[model samples]
Target: MNISIVLILLLAGAAFTFFAGNKFASKIALLVSVASFVFTLYALNLYLNGADLSCKSIWIQNPKIYFSLAVDGLSLAMLLLTTGLLPLIILSGWVTKFENEKAIYSLVLFMAFAMAGTFLAADGLLYYVFWELALIPIYFIALLWGNGSLEERKNAILKFFIYTFGGSLFMLVAFVYLYQKAGSLEIESLYALALTETEKTWLFLAFFLAYAIKIPLIPFHTWQANTYSKAPAIGTMLLSGIMLKMGLYSVLRWQLPITDTAAKEFMPYILGVSIAGVIYGAVLTLRQKNLKKLLAYSSLSHVGLIAAGLYSLTIEGFQGAVLQMLSHGLVIVGLFFVSEIIFNRWNTYTISEMGGIRSQATKFASFFMILVLASVAMPTTFNFVGEFTILYSLYNVNIGFAIVAGTTIILGAFYMLRMYQQTMLGETNTKVFADVTIVEGLVLLVIVVLVFFFGLYPKPIIELITPSLQNILNQIN
Candidate 1:
């Protein structure tokens, strides 16, 4: 199957949902998400069978780019992440009382469409366009549907918008510069670009600025907590669950090979920044009163280590990062949706106001406990394998770096257990507490099953991803 159909279906789905009116829009969107996901699985099978899935048409003449799209192991893994979470995202949105339901539903499909394009793009300008295209739908979703005072919402969304948009401009400049240097924006052509050490360093920083701000690494991460806090829960899922992976993916795809010498030159400092962010994010999570902000901060800590693994430049590191990206994407969607469920039932976001959910909702507590353990990288969950691989890679790089980064294990446990205890274990704060409805249970059950399934046997993904990372490493050399 041509992967372009996946993009076309998503875009078409968006338009159809926009005009389908309120009553049917959400259902149509969910159906479309599921259908696209099935096709992705087909595409993955075709790819493994040695069928060619890459296709391109001339997109521009003078600049020499194509509307090129292709899927490799790396791209397919990320594509799975995008397509897999989408149905769950849509399912979670079903509980939301969105104003202008059609617009919101349509925007979501548009976001998925753009992210899918990003993973598959075989051309740099095409990748950039899709990258920026993703920001718009989420922008409106946060600004229009988010819960906050109008001014507060505006401030948070705008910071997120401006910070990310500004970073994207740098990435555009780096691409443009590379295009001018190589006379082509095709991924392979740029990968083969010959630049002086100085030029590559500049390109490295330019791309890093973009990916860091998007990933919101460390100080660049100021935008994330506020934005995640204010955005609607569905939007939060898109951001944490999938959007953030774009940076880690970009590091593997764009920054690492293109800036090989520069990356090696600055490897110590770069890894230091990443390790610092891990500690920084975990520290901040300890004090958050708001549940969304806690998850947002926790995401930072996890991604910080994931980014560090990619920087470690080992196949095991890359393999673990890719798997963790998928695992984190699944777990975060369940986490945010749980927070949303809490808010839906109790009308509160503050931790102090939550308690005794376990007393009434054993099912919720069971599922929630699994996710909490997953976040903390417990065995028999997907995250444990990924986290182990990453820490092992870091240990190879430097024991001290590994030690610092390992703090996430402890810190993740600390905050997650505390949050679970305060929210689910203590005395009931209100009269009513309900078990997860069927839809919510269904979504989280998928997450739980996948988490365990992958952890027990991650060999398939590791084998698929290792060759791609090897290819990238070959390019870097």
Candidate 2:
């Protein structure tokens, strides 16, 4: 089966959802998400079983770009990540007490479709269109339904929208240059072009500025903490879980090949900046009392490691970065949702103000404990595999870098455990508290089970990524 149908199906689902209203919106959304997940699985099977599914249709004949969609090992991996987490994110929001649930539900489905389109689009212009399209639904979601003080939330959302869109302008410039140089706007055409060294360097910087802001590497990270902290739980999940990967994916798809020499030349400085982000983000995480702020900081630290991994330019490093992206996406969904549960119950997120929850709900405490351990990269969790791969890559690149980056493990444990202890281990500060509902328990359990499952057997993903890594690395020379 062709994968482009997935995008068509998703769009149909979004339209159906918009008309379905609140009563049927949730059920319709769930069904669509399940179907999308099935399609993702089908695509995976095609990829692994050696089926050919690349299809292209022209959208802008003048630009020579097509509404192209392909399912290669790399695109398939990202497609799986996009479609897989979506149902879970939708499920999390299914239980949320959102106003105008129909609109919210429809928007979620739309965002999923947009993300899937972004991942699968093979034409440069088409990909950028989907990339920008994905941001619109999220902007409204964050601005209207987010949790912070209204003015603060609006400011944060505005800043986030502006910062990312502003950065994307550079990407557009880079793409225009490629179209000029390659004589076609197709990504493959651009990949095949042999640009002068000077041209490659300039294009690389343009792409780098765009992605660095999306990844929000240290200096460009000014907007992330506030945006994440203020966004609604599901909005935050979409931002951290799937949106950030867009930037990283672009690095592999466009940046690396377009300017392999530049990547090699600037590896040391890029690596150093990434490590600095790791240290800087972790230190700030340790100091945060707000649950959301802490997670935001932790995200900074995690993405820093991924960035470093990519810059290492080793097969292991590239694979590890991909694994880390998947791992972090899952863990952050749980982490943010857990915080949402707490906010729903107690109406506060301050660690210092919460206590004695172990008695109130052993289930809550237990689930929190599992997520904490996973976040800190306890040996048996999927996070451990991500960290191990990244650190192993780092060790090969530079042992000192790995050692310095590894300190995040220590700091991660300290903050997570300290938060757990303060929030769940003290005397019963308040009598009224609720254990996780059955749905909450089931959600947490699934996440925990997957964490352990992938941790124990990452062979599947490693094999899936290896061919793609080899393809990319072959081009480096």
* Candidate whose lDDT is highest: 1
Q: List lDDT for all candidates, in order.
A: 0.93, 0.86
If scored against the real structure, what TM-score would every candidate get?
0.99, 0.98
Off by over 4 Å in 2: none
**Candidate 1 collision pairs:** none
Number of the top-ranking candidate, with TM-score as the measure: 1
Residues 140-167 of candidate 2 have per-residue lDDT tens digits of: 8888888878899889989988989998
Cα RMSD to the true fold for all candidates: 0.8, 1.2
Q: Which pairs clash (backbone N, Cα, C closer than 3 Å) in model 2?
A: none
User: What global local distance difference test value does model 2 have?
Assistant: 0.86
Residue 336 in model 2: shift from native, Å?
0.4
